[model samples]
Target chain A: MSPLHLCLALSAALFCTGLVAVLIRGNAILVLLGVELMLNAANLNFLAFWRFGPGGGEAGLVFVLFSIAVAAAEAAVGMALVIAVHRHLRSIRIADANRLKG
Target chain B: MTTLLAVLALICLAPAVAAVLVRNLIHSALLFVLAWLGLAAFYLALGAEFVAFAQALVYVGGVSMVALFAVLLTRPGRTDLLPPPSAARAVGGLAAVSLVASMLASSLFWSRLPSMEPTAPIPLRRLGELLAGPYLVAVLLVGLILTVALIGGLLLAAPRRPAEGADA
Candidate 1:
């Protein structure tokens, strides 16, 4: 079996586990962790494809760098929002914030 | 190579599962850090040293800290950090994830992929050139986005004065 396939399989497994975490966990922070896992899975795929693809992986490296930067921004803003939600609602549970529901 | 892959896979996934299954939020968050470290190892195995270090610095050093701090800052008294998932809900999550994973693995077999070349790793110098050359605009935009996010995070998480909210 090709190493690429193994990497791809690993990425798939990580992504799936993240999906389960996002669905099964109630804590907003855990959900955020799940999202981080998903993002890392995607990043892994990028690296694998870049390595195994016909051309050089320069493009993939650049893309992964950009993705890392964006993920950092996303994590910062998401955590900040979580803190704000907790301040307003007194709880960080996703189900607890239902004030705007009709 | 295959053995390294196996070890890295175990390092990455075992903690991921533990992170999800663990009861304590702080422990789960730290487990997530271990998972990210495994991901960095994967990058290193692919011979992408620059990307791997960036992964460790950004995820391990930066994002994980933010998550842990979010957990610490928000929690006050003795309360449930993670309420257990209902039986039906847990089963559904497992079923859905398995379905998606099977679909993804099946699709990978349908296409004939190129074999990897044992080429030298991309140098950090070349990467810097690419960032400043063809990908300049994207790099600039990422910088702008990160700056905005930093400022926005500060604005959102800053404590408010009582006088400001007295009218409300």
Candidate 2:
């Protein structure tokens, strides 16, 4: 396979693994990790296209930088949410957090 | 080069799989760090040195610490007593994920992507100018969002005050 194809395949695999983790994992923190993995996969795709495609690639680089910053902010907020949930429920399991069931 | 890319792919993927499967939350978090490092290696191989270092700093350094802290704060003394997911739920989730993966893979292979020789890496100075000149608004917006998120996270995680009337 060409390098671009290789990168795309790797990105797809990583994204799928992350999806499985998010779908099956019970812990909220692990779910957040899955989200991070998916975000990284997208970043990989951007860099791959930037390297292999025509033009300056400036847009892709800037986009990845912004994406990384957003992911960091997301992790901070997500962890805080997880901590708050644990404080309230004394557990972080997704199955255990069902207070809003109506 | 293909062989090196394959190795990097393995490095990037294996820890991620292990992180999902591991029983200990702390171990899982650390495994995620390894996976992130592997992704940084991929960036380096792709010739994006700045992105590679940024990935290492933000993900391996910052995000890993956050994940570990969350795990520790939540777990405290109790080990993970949660039972494994029910067989039906696990099967359903796996099936859905597999279906999605297959679809994505098929589409990616079918599409006609334009391929060219890998280009020279953009200079660090040029990147700075683009960020400051054209993308300055986006940078400022990101700064605002980060500040807001920081304050919001602090508020959410802060300890609540006891009811004074009830105590009295």
Candidate 3:
């Protein structure tokens, strides 16, 4: 009933949704969104544990801040790679990248 | 009161599912933004101010923009149509649903859980100090990893101009 439990449940659900998106979606962008969802879900877990765990207040907050910095850098590099690959391949559909089947 | 919190959890999840399931790419992207905002609010309600800011600034602002830009770059004339659903997708959905159900059941039925209230939370400065103290080795390793990743990304994304000997 507590907000902490609520955060956990939502994070779990989002992670599952992301799992489905990653497995089912053919588009690379959709897959990237799924990845973002999973990352956010993990972030929520950290924050919730912070709020309710034995390390409340600022320790969790500090860790979450570091996580955000990491996520931002990851996003930048990931999108750049996506752009570069798109330029080389002219398509974003994961299915279209059939050369990898070998 | 517990029921209300559970219901709100469902509300938070429903849009995330929709964001994943929608066939339209643009709709999926927009729904993803909403999902981030929802999670950010949830983080705030849970008394995680730093997490809320990170969700707002990093995922909402940085990741989402990058995703949208990637979408714009790779989409071709296929923008007018929906991608056909595949047979394998059903199994993936089933797996995801089963994972969610199992996690929910465990959380609901688990007889014992640790709930500790913090008495002395180290401040952000202390966290940094700790990271630099006993955790210094791990921090240094992560820094090295990130540095390599950045260099790799730069090597990959460096732009190339058009050839000079093209059809002049």
Ranked by TM-score, the better of candidates 2 and 3 is 2
How does each model score on TM-score?
0.92, 0.94, 0.78
Please list all clashing residue pairs in model 2, or write none if there are none: none
| Model 1: residue B89 alpha-carbon error in angstroms | 3.0
lDDT by residue (tens digit), candidate 2, B1-168: 678988999999999999888877888888999999999999998889999999999998899999888887887466744457678878998999999998999999898888789878999999999999999999999999999999999998877875467544
Which candidate gets the maximum DockQ versus the true structure?
A: 2
Candidate of highest TM-score: 2
Clashing pairs in 1: none
Candidate 1 to native Cα RMSD, angstroms: 3.1
Number of the top lDDT candidate: 2
- B1-168 per-residue lDDT for model 3 (tens digits): 346546656666778888877887878888888888877767656655555766788777877887777777666575634465588876776777787769776975673446555334345577668678866775676677678767876766666775477556
Local distance difference test, candidate 3: 0.70
List ranges where model 3 is wrong by over 4 Å.
A55-59, A100-102, B1-11, B78-81, B96-100, B115-151, B159-168
Candidate 2 Cα errors over 4 Å, as ranges: B80-82, B162-168
Residue B66 miss distance in model 2 (angstroms): 0.9
Whichever of 1 and 2 has more TM-score, that candidate is 2
Q: Please report, as a residue range, the 10-residue window in candidate 3 chain B with the lowest summed lDDT.
A: B111-120
Best to worst by lDDT, what's the order?
2, 1, 3
The sequence of per-residue lDDT tens digits that candidate 2 reaches over residues A1-102 is 888889999999999989988988878998999999999999999998898877677799889999999999999999999998898888788878899742
